[model samples]
Target: MSSNLAGNQATERKRRIEKYFQPTPKDSLKQIAVALLAGGGIAVLLGLILLSSQSFLAVLLFIGGGYALVQGAIRKARYKAEYEKAEPKPSDREMDRTLALDLQQIEDRAMHRLGITADHLETGAASWDPVAALLADKMVERPKKRPLVLYGPKLSDFGIGEDGVWRFKLYEVLVICPTVHHLAIYHCSLDFLSGGLSMEDTEEYQYNHVVAVSTRTTPAPADLSLERLNTRDPEDDEVRFAKVLRRRLEVSVSNGQSIGVTVGITDEQDSSKQAVLQSSGIDEVIGSVRRVLRDHSRP
Candidate 1:
């Protein structure tokens, strides 16, 4: 009577648990059978060893274990096959469409898909000397070793909005050995910069690129020099400096947002130094800033 009552309670408890955590019939059966067979075999082996089991008993135990193993294998194979069958395959048309687009177009489409706004994009260029690439690879390979500093008042001037919120980063470009026909590129971002930006479901980080080019150039002056210019807003010393450079060299600023530069060796001695900025897409990104920079720079 006590055993019967205990069994009834266990059954009731199992039913209640199953109501909240329902599993498929096949899976539940397989799990229960595997657990029971495994536990029972282990218990029987221990018991038989203690009892000094007859040869016939040992043979029966071995046969049962083999059967259990085969059963488990069959169930696992079926489960894997069912899972693969359930997954959807992409259509050929979809794959073809993706393969058809050029890199720039692909970038644009990805941006559109992610719902990134024009305001969300930030553009900047870094010189890509082979020496620099090697140095950069060192940094990239061991990011934690070289902790980036987020310090300094310079970052503060990046701006705070009228609503008392700060604008974060949305996009970034690292141009390596930029030239008229080709460039080497590295794209990156920090979470702080991208946190507020809206992006597409499938899109994660802003697109980054590395490119190489073979032709054309933008001229840079013989001496790399810096000069400060006064501005209405002291906070924009960096922007003002950029503006001064644009005025002197004819680089452009776009949408009050982007900076478009045309950089190269000024003369014959600087051939290997090469052009560092001459990207059409860079102009597209900077918008009318291109005209401002180009017009000013034109001889």
Candidate 2:
């Protein structure tokens, strides 16, 4: 009796869980209808071929009825299986797109308020593969005038992607300006840009350089530093961004020398910054950032 009671309880719990996760009747019906149409059509074709000698009208009706029954049953079983199986969450691409849209609005607002130049916008996932190094490798192939700005590796230091793939996802934006000095890549510092409404311990990264953009609103280095990455008003635009920070230590097998590009973002502005970084390579990126600062500081 106790065993039977325990089994009953287990079954009840399972039924409750099923009720929680199962798709609505409307969704189930849609899936079933689609499946039945597809399967029934195939069954009809097969039946006609197999019973070619039988009365055409009889075969037609028989096949139609048989197909409906079999297909409906199969679809119901398939739908149940689908409901039981774990479903995949939405992709990180959704988050990246949202972040991109928000950042663009922010840029527009900032540009309007500050009277600055607004550049092109681009967003995509940044993954740490040998492929990323190829981006670095390709940078060497550019013309002498076009320098490379190693923005740093994205998405290994703990950031979430659109699909909830927090382990290996990166959100990037690139802005292309005219000069080499304008190239700068800002990453989301997992710690700083995150947290409360205020941004702190801000960091700046340029071609082969890293500096704190601001420390609790305190000005740090003038060169390669940003006066303002934000538009200074929410009314100006929507702010959306994401970043991944990672440290890579490259050690030589021949010589014991090492250097690394630590990836991170300081603000939503980095998403806009990335667009510039991608367009003109490194030199142009640096130039753009400097120009924005110069214009922002002008009386």
Candidate 3:
């Protein structure tokens, strides 16, 4: 009696779960009608051929139907096996612990690279408000109703540049949302313009338009230190440095409609700055964003 009661409870639970995913009445009716029409047509055709004294044709029809049914059953079994293999077997607590550890490691690495403490680091979900405001101020399209999560380090300390005319602060933000993920935004603010251009003159320049996106690639490590390479022989240096200078990521969207800017974190025009950016965990961040994009883009 106890065993029967347990089985009944298990069956009831399954039914409740399946109820949410069950097809609508309209869809079920349409599928049934199609199946009936196809099966009935095949049966009628085979029956008519059998009645016409075509014993050989009837045999062929039976053979064909049997082959088709066997193939269908095989395919169904294969699909079920594959699905079972892919399903996670771990307990919920185990999965949660693994995920938590991974996130903690990522956060720690990011904080170390950005020179920020734990207090300065905000959870991805909490950081979206500032990003939304920035988008609104720039008249950019706001993200959809879907959840937006962003992991951002606090702004860097203000410092005056060598030119003495400009003081700036720099920081990086990581955005993860339903449609967009692992998006890294490098931000900079200059206290004043150095080239006779007033602060007002640069105000018209849209910084948001500078956003860009790229897919990351892992290249074999090579030493490209200029000091170690022969500076006198330009050709030799170029040949040796070529492999090291290869881009770690390829641009996907430049001035894209979704992000409203080219997402390039480093300026290609400045080779020195580009090299520095590459070494400073920019590739890792971009790689994360690319992964998220790929996962979400799938049907």
Candidate 4:
């Protein structure tokens, strides 16, 4: 029936996504060949020009082509070196182990901060489509590697305000990037009245850019000034949401990197509840991310 068809479609979509993430050695080799060939072609054209006319212009052309060929060779060598150093993709068992460890670490941190264990916390691999889609709209260029997103347990509570004018719902989404040494946390909420929309807002924060692993509760070390803030309002919620989460971590190339954290908040009825949840959620995620980064940095 319709349910089965929908299930089949979902399965096919996931299969395609997984296939896309698989490494393609053949395609990489082909790209290397193409770059080298293009460089060689430029060199051959310059040689022909020099044979016809041995002038200053011909020498300049020769030098340009030589530079291109050298660059191509360098790139090819880099590609080969990277391929050699690349580790094989983890097996299903290994992935499961990694996921479990990541979840357990986050859960431990959450329990310590919230003072209550999240028994109903759900865990799963976050879909890449949404992340990719957001990046496509927000970034001029995509990241070299698709970030591995693992959704940690969510903390949510609902209550009716004393005035009875609106009901308040507070929830925190803890999304961790286990593969990468940074985090971006978004906290969004909706305020509506009798099935009608009222208002929605989002805020973002970026964190640590040091090569050393350290814990600090300050504004993210990135260059987020008043001038960088957007002046116009966006029509689409997704567009606005993506904009709020578009900041990147300043990573150090030498001694690894520190955890990057971001926080977004949207409140409708009670500011106190929103602030408390937001602060606790941000603290929990930052601690969790720092723990993961420290473990990765250790030899």
Instruction: Give the RMSD in angstroms, all C-alphas superposed, for model 4.
Output: 21.4
Task: Rank the models by lDDT, top first.
Answer: 4, 2, 3, 1
Q: Which candidate is the best by TM-score?
A: 4
Candidate RMSDs in order: 23.8, 20.0, 22.8, 21.4
Which portions of model 1 miss their true places by more than 4 Å?
Answer: 1-26, 29-33, 36-52, 87-299
Summarize candidate 1's per-residue lDDT along 101-143 as a digit string, tens digits.
Answer: 2223334444455444434433223211212222232212111
lDDT of each: 0.30, 0.34, 0.33, 0.34
Per-residue lDDT for 176-234 in model 2, tens only?
A: 22222322232222211211111111122232332212112112233322222322121
For model 2, the run of ten residues with the poorest summed lDDT: 191-200
| Separate clash counts for every candidate | 9, 34, 7, 0
lDDT of 3 by residue, 10-74 (tens): 56543432222122233344445455445545854785679569877777766665555555555
lDDT of 2: 0.34
TM-score attained by model 1: 0.19
State the number of backbone clashes in model 4. 0
Alpha carbon deviation, residue 112, candidate 4 (Å):
17
Clash tally for model 2: 34
Instruction: List model 4 lDDT by residue over 1-299, tens digit each.
Output: 99898678656533432322233344466487567759766775877767666766666767777776777777777666644433243333333233334334443443344333233222122223222322232212213322222231111222211221111122222333333333332222211111111222222222333343233323322443222322111121221211111222222224353333223222222222221111122333334445655655566
